[model samples]
Target chain A: MDSTCRRMRAEILDISFSSGHGHIPTCFSVVECLYAAYEVMRHDPKRPDWAERDRFVLSKGHAALGYYAVLAQHSYFDIKEVAGFGAYNSRFGCHADRTKLPGVEASTGSLGHGIGIAVGMALGERVAGRQTKVFTLIGDGESNEGSVWEAVMVANNVGLNNLTIIYDHNKSQGRCLPVTNPGERFRSFGCEVVEVNGHNVDALKEVFARPATGVRAVIADTVKGYGCKTLVDNVNEWHRKSPDAEQLAKLLEELHAPAI
Target chain B: MRRQFKETTTALAATDPRVAVVLGDVSVYMFMDFHRANPGKFYNMGICENSLISVAAGMTATGMRPFVHTIAPFLTERSLEQIKLDCAYNQWPVNIVTCGASFDYAWDGATHHCYTDLAILRLLPNMEVLQPGSRREVDALMRATYDSGKPTYIRLSDHPHDVETNLEFGKGTVLREGKSGVTVMTAGPILPNVMAACEDLDVNLVYFHTLKPMDRALVERFRHDRILVVHDAFGLQEAINEVPGLRTWYHGLPDQFCAWYGTVHDIRARIGLDAPGIRKAVTTLLETPSA
Candidate 1:
């Protein structure tokens, strides 16, 4: 794992332990994907509402903790402020609200909604004759929603070359309905599909930098828990579980351990 | 009313440049001139109702005024969550202009019928619900609030009442004032029937185009009298009840579906919303002894 992502994982564990609120594994799954997005997107952290800036929506909003950490790393806000996440009257809720948060473009919690809104943003840019690109990240689990497919079909039919969908194929829906062969599915829907190891920020950034012919779908194959071995091994157990003091120390140690 | 919608929206698009129309393949032919005049401003975005709303909300976020037009039931009911979350909750200013109000597509069966749209949508925060009863009202209301930067749902009907109304956004008009103390309240296309029903009877008539931000002050003015909410749908009665200290009864849809296939007028007549049927209900209310 990248040292910065490892540090972000440690931060996630710390916040989860303190606030007792987080989907830890899901948050871990998209760290690099979110990081690569911010690195490649044409956004000024200081001017989030710059009319010419590119837009990104976190369709699978369960991983808002990861999103906040990445936004903080990019200087949208201080990571220290995120400790108050999910607390009463806190700007950062369990799911992000666009009005409250600085970097969030759309407030998305209900699965299958953010992608559709992202489609509109891209199409709206085309209508206005602007060069703004719109990106959205959706989970393999969220792909279970019919609205997700509906949005994909609409984006393709509308010929939105400015729209790119980052599909986090983390296989979190191993127990329920898993979206198998997502790259093939997106290809069938007329999207330019790319497969990449999601945790590799370099490969993800390369894919994000490339121009596309039509609506693009980056199938990011990832592990539910990417950094800590304990969380990776016991994914279900650590899915929504906040850590105790001992558990947090163990997770942090595992995250910082040298890889073979 | 759909023609009025196209006319008003077409006019707005000429100058505003932000006005875009997204259709669900329902009234594509009516907007042919519009599609030609403004190339990229209009899209026949297929039958995905949920995506239509989400896309419209997206367009609204991009500084364009978008109108999502389609059949009433599919646009409002099938895609309720999109409207509630993507538009209302997110505070995106998209205009939802739907046709096939109530039994407008009655021949297509119960799947096409929609009476719950206005009632359910009015409950969402930061939503504006309007059922304009005439072409004039449609034109005026669209001009008033199309770019107000609020999520607005305008339910257009094939059966406009053809009556001259107050034309205000939230204020209801007193079409007739009678000595008899009974105030017959109604909304949308049902007003013509309501008008004919109360023509001979000694009763005051009240009409509304806006459902939310409902003319509460006007509703309060008729509080002393028995307010009989007569309409072809569920929302007007619920809206009237928003004002306290008023006695209101709904004369609209029953608990079950109007299962038979017919025209909108046929269904209305069968369900006691036509002129004579409405007159019978009003006369019975007037004859009943006051409590």
Candidate 2:
């Protein structure tokens, strides 16, 4: 896993493992990509509604733990907010709620909505004569939704060079679901596909740095639980299962404290 | 009706810069002039209703007042979720204008029929539903909804209109005012049918182009009298339910898929929504004593 994003993952683990109701594995899978994307995004924490601020929506919304952690790490809220993960009046919902949270651009637990919304945001910038860029992250499983392809075709037809889509390709069909080929499919939709190691923060940063052109997509290849040994070995099997107290200790030991 | 919508959309763009249009490639020619007039504001978003709605919401978030148009079934049923979550849940003001009301494309078969648009959109808590019966009402309601700053659903029907009346949110205009304790109320192009039905009777006739904030005050007028709701849909039932005690007889398409295909008039006859059928239903309600 990218060391720069490891701390964010640790925060995510604590929130989800403690809440006992979160997508820990899915959140872990996209940490490196989100960390890299959030860093290079032209956004201001104080001015969350800044008209020209770069917009990011997690279409793979189950990975809200990681998204919330990243926002907290960016100082959108205090780190202490993570402790109240799924609390009754928490700004952070189980899925990202733009209404509740400051940094969240859209509420997106429903699999395949983010891309189209992002496309509209890109078009909004065009209409207003602003150079703001819109970015979204989707899952390998989410591409199965026809709305994703619908937006893909619209984005292609509209020539939205200011939009960027990052697919966290964890191959998460879970045996029953077919592992769809997002890279080739995206290419067919006329997106400029660039594959990167999602675990490598530097590589993700470099891929994102290449200025948005022609509705580009970054197929970040990574595993569902990259660094956590118990979760990493078995892909997505321990996804929804929150760790027990004993398991949480071992997870913290491996993720938080390096072997001195 | 489509031509009027296109003209109104162009006129709206001329006055309001925030007005933008996105269609599902269904009405290409209808928007050509608007596209030429407002370069980046009008977009033919292809035949993707889900994307069209979400994209409209996205544009709304960035301070753009976006109006989406497509077939009734495709726009309402296909993208209902997006309309609920993306537009209504977020309180983003999106103007959803749908053509092919009920079965405007009767020969196109069951796939094109949309009898439950009122029910479908009414069930969603956030949408304000409007159905324009005449050319004047269409222009008035469209302009009002665009400037209303709330998510709205407008149905454009091929039904002709002779009455010229103003529109207000949650209010109905009294077309043929009467105080015989029996009022015939309806919305959309069907208004003409109800008028034809009650043409010989000494009864009240009201038209509610807007359904959501239904003119509850109008219900007060018919508090003790019987009501003949012509296309009585969506908020009418609930509004009537609230009038303490009153008699209501509703006539519209039934709650089943239109089993056969024919002209819109034939389909209306089959479903008992034609002028004669409506008149008969109103006569029956008029005979019933208010208990």
Query: Number of the top candidate by TM-score?
Result: 1
Q: Model 1: runs farther than 4 Å from truth?
A: none
* TM-scores of the candidates in the order shown: 0.99, 0.95
Please state the CAPRI-style docking class of candidate 2.
Answer: medium
Local error of candidate 2 at residue B177 (angstroms): 4.7
Deviation of model 1 at B182, angstroms: 0.9
Clashing pairs in 2: B170-B213, B170-B215
Clashing pairs in 1: none
lDDT by residue for model 2 (B96-178), tens: 99888777888888799876777677767778888777777778778777867779998887765767665665678887866
Interface RMSD (Å), every candidate: 0.6, 0.7
Per-residue lDDT of A132 in model 2: 82
